[model samples]
Target: MNYTLHQLQVFLKISQTLSITRAAEELNLTQPAVSIQLRNLQDQFDIPLTEVIGRRLYLTDFGREIALAAEKVLNEAYAINHRTLAHKGLLYGKLKVSVVSTGKYVMPYFLTEFMRQHEGIELVMDVTNRQKVVDSVANNEVDFALVSILPPHLNVARLDLMPNKLYLVGAGPTGQLREEAEPELLKKLPLIYREAGSGTRQMMESFLAAHQIVVKKRLELTSNEAVKQALLAGLGYSVMPLIGLKSELLNNDLQILPMAGLPLQTVWMLIWPKDKQFSPVAQAYLAYIRDHKDAIVQQHFGWYERFL
Candidate 1:
């Protein structure tokens, strides 16, 4: 705990390189100074951080723990500095967003357009399922989240953009999945499904649950693309976000199933923690989305409607 930032840096460098002389050279500090800093840290902790097993220094468990923590501290400090520069009209920062997997299918172009305008801002995107995206926001792993199906959680705040309509898509002998089929026949095909914790999957289940309809044959996949692939190969069929398989639907690679119980709906949202002081980068994305709210809804919903 008595380690200064410089001391932690030295400790990390030495732990990584396992050579005191090399780490000191890398830090442009004399070997003696680096040794002194390390000794001070060890004395403060009352433990040996590095051990001389033979000729090399190896990080003990405590040393590794401190090194990992040091990296977080340094990265967050850099993020704070970037945020400060951005808020002063510098408009330079890394915008990190966690998104639902289906959203990754369509949101990149919008993000790219923004990146072009604010060339100084970098984009970091993590595409995952809805639960993971929410967890990222609540745990501060990402600055914000773009979610298509907002889960029921009290810790996060969501901005309701629009309701997302689900589609039951497949590749089975189809002009359209429902072209010649009636409702009872439509449910007979292999039902490819999103994995548990998928907001879309939950919505689909809930919709069917209302009618006491449960898909007897269910094949679960992690991502929308994986579901599409499985459907195309005739492994199974799935209910999916329309964004994921638009080209497939148009090109007849897949077909939308026409069933009375299909095409369930869930709300699309942008969510973040309710912290008082979110980073400038996070705040900027929120502000940008708020300002361009209409344009975003029009774009995605318009695309969703096109296939209908």
Candidate 2:
């Protein structure tokens, strides 16, 4: 009936990945070591926690519940350690943030100096899709969430960090379309899209709908990198944030299409639930960002001003 915290951590990772090999790789443990830990953890529970079907591992319903509980336990344990450090007047803790996929490009630049200055602080940034990012915010799983589009239903406080400009971009040279081409010309070309719940996809749909322009949907990809790869392959055009395309644009591997109503605009914001309480690390981050965002933007993203 006695399971250690290490066992819980191992079980939680296994549940997340659903593969012993993958879990072992992530945890930097050997496969046999991970299996022994999992076995020991499973022995403490009477019911089945995981099962193997064919070649794949799957968590049982009971395993899923246990994993959630394990996460809560681990979070509290970490909180206690962080709290003790803070009481000692040290800026030490894990700073958790969930960012939309494309936001990875922006959030890291803002974080660099803060992280450098506070060497004791640890960062756990999850780069995920819009829906998951919003879910993390709603669940209060992270101190902040970085997004270009604000969730309409969430009552949250936000800090505007920088401008997020999206453009209809295609692969190869700039002469693909005339400067005065009608917006309706989009109908003739295929369009690559982010998955449905992505902020980029949502903005793309809203922009097209507003212009009453319906284009052909050629492909749907889950990550910005995948979408960019598709664009480079000449698969189709897509509405993409310029932050992620800076290198591509400079190299002339991609070009912005000329059309009216171009450069869909949104601001990058760091948002948290309005009612949530902050940790010492989170408060320090907020203060740092508030005081330094202007200077950080000027240093890191001043080139983006040309697109605005």
Candidate 3:
């Protein structure tokens, strides 16, 4: 009860990042300052909030509960601030977005245009993998999320954003592999795979399952860029989203292998919890992207056609 919202804010940031250093950097505060705020905040509680184990930081059970409560408090506070600005006829607020890694290719364009139109808006974007994005959605940690696969259990409002086409890509001459999309041929080739919990990896698994194929998992990469680099080095083939491969495809650093039932088509969706109230800025962005999806896609992604 003695803690200020500032303390809660700092604690929440630390909880989200699991790094006092990162939380301090994000909040534009010194590490000592952040530590002081955390110390002051924890003084009011009888139980320890967090623990450091083997150079890694973790929230205790009580810390996790308090972090969740802090999020709700901050969200409501922001909502009030939004209303106050609206009363003054001002468009000033923060927009928090959590996006899956592949969505990094598309979200910046949308956010750039939106921020350009509203100079007072603050944007906080987290580009994480699908699992983290899903956790954000589940925990109501972000205003919106951009992802390829929608979680079936969450009650959410989904707006279809754009098509996400995944291709089986590799380095080397285009015809080095057999022309046919045969399971036997693909199984023999070295495959570079995204780490587990990736939406792309899950989709690739389903695609391979449909074909009854099992590939040689030569490398497991943590990021799309890593996978792309491995492909360029001829380390292995991978199923990659076309959005992530536009430049490489154009430069002939990578080639999409010809195959039956390839280029698996999925749709990107913008989602927020159905029950959550949106701030004026969040509502405006939702409407703007919905209204301008085609133009946005054409403007940002028109180059895709020349390569396709």
Candidate achieving the largest TM-score: 2
Where does model 1 exceed 4 Å of error? Answer: 1-89, 172-183, 297-301
TM-scores across all candidates? 0.66, 0.78, 0.74
- In candidate 1, which residue pairs clash? none
TM-score for predicted model 2 compared with the true structure = 0.78
Per-residue lDDT for 60-89 in model 2, tens only? Answer: 999999999999999888788778867887
RMSD of 2: 4.6
RMSD of 3: 5.8
Overall local distance difference test of candidate 1: 0.74
TM-score of 3: 0.74
How do the candidates rank by lDDT, highest first? 2, 3, 1
What does candidate 3's lDDT look like per residue over 100-138, in tens digits? 998999899887888888866889999998888988988
The model with the greater TM-score, 2 or 3, is 2
On lDDT, the leading prediction is 2
Clashing pairs in 2: none
lDDT, candidate 2, at 121: 92
lDDT of 2: 0.90
Q: Write the per-residue lDDT of candidate 1 for residues 223-296, one digit (tens) a residue.
A: 77788899998887666777677778878888776767666776667777777366666677678777776787
Query: What is the Å distance of residue 86 in model 3 from its true position?
Result: 5.0
